[model samples]
Target: MRERIVVTGAAGFIGSNLCKMLLQEGYSVVAIDNLLAGTLENLPEGVDFKKVDVCDSDFSRYVEGAIAVFHLAARNCLDDCAKNPVDTARINVMGTANVLQACVEYKVPHVIYSDTSAEYEGINMFPSKIDSVKPMSIYACSKRSGALMAEGFKNYYGLNISTVRYFNVYGPAQDWRRVIPPVMSAFTIKLLQGESPFIYGTGEKRRDFIHVDDINRFHLMLIREKLIQGGTYNLGSGEDYSILEIFEKIESEICSGIKPIFKPELSGEAFRTLADISETCKTGWTPQVTLEAGIKSFVAYTRERLRLG
Candidate 1:
């Protein structure tokens, strides 16, 4: 039998993509999601998909006989998390604890926790290193709570866990239906429809955007090599671009001739984010996708999706 891998939030953007990658690599994927923010359409075929919430008491049964578990389920929208902090905590914190407990009980060999660079919100430093983190928003704080739970499992239960902090990941199947969507998806979708995209704040905030494919490359490496056990890593392009810069790049590809509409900035977000990937690079995984190429391909994908709809 092929090695089995369990993925939480397996219908969401990154989870869905990761499931596809694991399936391609000959692993039997058991996907779990509640469809709260994820859609059934996003899930790929051949997965033993269960419409289950992470916090469900019976969630442990899915972890049985799995070699690894990727805990990606979380309430991650900044605005939504800010407004519904209680719900966010219930999902990101309590839910994560439940998942870790299941992993511990089942003696899963390895566990991968999906973290975010938003942990650097209160810091002013460039090229954010993994050691220092000061999360300011509800979303970040809840995720930090989850990370702490994972740490506890690693320390007390000896659960081998690796935490990966991602910075502005984007690609096809990116969530475009959120109350406040990611900039890349929002801009691409609006431009494809000949409408003006909204730019929250001054459009000057700098962000480190890494393609989803590059992220999955690093993920596959971690699973296959098990290079750094119980380590925290940053996955990013190690480069920062302003919001306007990203808009220009996307507009250049689409030639939409539509300018963005300025709006008040969203609260509880960092002004800038850049990843320090030196340690991650030592693991022999470097980002393979270029921003230019990634954006161009993403534009084409968005156009095709719009055309189909």
Candidate 2:
């Protein structure tokens, strides 16, 4: 019999991609999402889906008989988390606790948790490592709390839970509010209308942008290999590039006529973020796609989607 896996937030970008991979690998998938930050359109075809929030009381019952659980649901908006820390904690922190409790009760053998790079904040360290997390925002703090909760469950209940901290993941189905997608969207829209797109923060800040396909691939590799237990790994390209460089690459690739107008920095935005993927590399996985290639593919995807609609 194929192993049963439960993926929370299965309608979100990463979750949907993971679910598609799981189905392709011949695993039975139970995909549950509240459609709060995820949508039905994002989910892959021919999978079991439930429109239920992770924080709901019935969530525990859904975990019964599952072999493993992949918890990815969270309030991803940093600005919203800053505005309402209570809601952030309720969904990210408490909701994670609920999942952990269910995993324990259901006798699920393993739980893979998806953490974020936001947790590696305030430290002046370049290529931040997994062990050096100093959360600066409410979203980061909430996620860190969930990581600690996973650790706690491992210590007490001996539940095999591992975490993967994702860097700036950009590819198809990324939320438009995120940096890369918004920039691409703005540029594409302006190019058609003969206008210029704006850039924030002088474009000096650097980020370690990993292709979502690579991220999903590495995650599946981790699960199949079962390398780590109760530890965290960073999933990234182990390469960093300035925002200006990325913009120039995009402009050269897609929009050459329109110049970017610089704007003031956004509040609560990290100035620099790079991932140290030594741990992930130990798992025999490395990013196979280049930024330029991924961006081109993403642009084509969006363009085709628009044309179809």
Candidate 3:
């Protein structure tokens, strides 16, 4: 029998991609999602899917006989989280605890947690190191709460766990339908439609964007090689690009004449984000896609989806 891997947010953007890779590697994937923020269309074929929320008391049954449980389900919309901190806490904090409890109860050998770079929002250090976090937003706090809970499980139950803090991940099947979609997706979608996209702030905010393929590569490494256990690693490009620069890069390819409508800056967001991926790099992994190449692929995918040339 092949490895049975359970992914909590199997219908989500990154989660869907991870599931596809796992299937390609011949693993039997048991995917779970409540469909609140994920769609069934995103899941690959041959998956044992259950429309389940991670917060359920008996969610652990899905993890039975699994090699590892990849916990990717959470309320991740930053602005929405800011407006409804309680809802955010309920899903991201308590929900995470429920998943961890399930892992412990099931005696799963390994757990690969999908953490966020949002935890570093209040810290100004460039190329953010995985130390001394200062989360500014409610969403950031929720993610931190999950990490803390994971630590508790590690200490008490001796469960093997590894955390990957992602930095602005993007690629095909990106969530372009959110009220505030990722900048790259929003830009490509709007430009392909010949509409002016909105820029929330001055478009000067710098962000470290990593291609989802690059992230999946490391995910494969973690699962197959078991390179680093019980450690946290940053999944990023180790390079930063300003919002305006990213806009220019996308616009130059999709629709040259479109201009973005500028608006007041969003609250509870960091002005800049750059990941210090030195630890992850030590394992002989590096980002493989260049920004231009990545953007070109994004534009092509968006155009095809919208039936545009």
**In TM-score terms, which candidate is top?**
1
Residue 226 deviation, candidate 3, in Å? 2.9
Better candidate by lDDT, 1 or 3: 1
Worst 10 residues of 1 by lDDT: 221-230
Error of 3 at 207 (Å): 0.5
The top-ranked prediction according to lDDT is 1
Q: Candidate 3 residues 1-309, lDDT tens each? A: 899999988899999999999999999999999998899989999999999999888888989999988999988988878889998998988998898888889899999889999999988878899986899888899999999989999999898889999999999888878898999998888887888889988999999999999998988888776657788999989999999999999998875698999989988778999999999999888999989999999888888888843
Model 1 lDDT tens row, 1-309: 999999999999999999999999999999999998888888989999999999999889999999999999998999888889999999999999999999989999999999999999999988999999999999999999999998999999999999999999999889999877999999999998999999999999999999999999988887888657679999999999999999999999999899999999877779999999999999988998999999999999989888888
Question: What is each predicted model's overall lDDT from 0 to 1?
Answer: 0.93, 0.83, 0.90
* Candidate 1 residue pairs in clash (backbone atoms < 3 Å): none
Model 3 alpha-carbon drift over 4 Å, by segment: none
lDDT of 1: 0.93
Which model, 1 or 2, shows the larger TM-score? 1
lDDT (Cα, 0-100) at 13 in candidate 2: 83
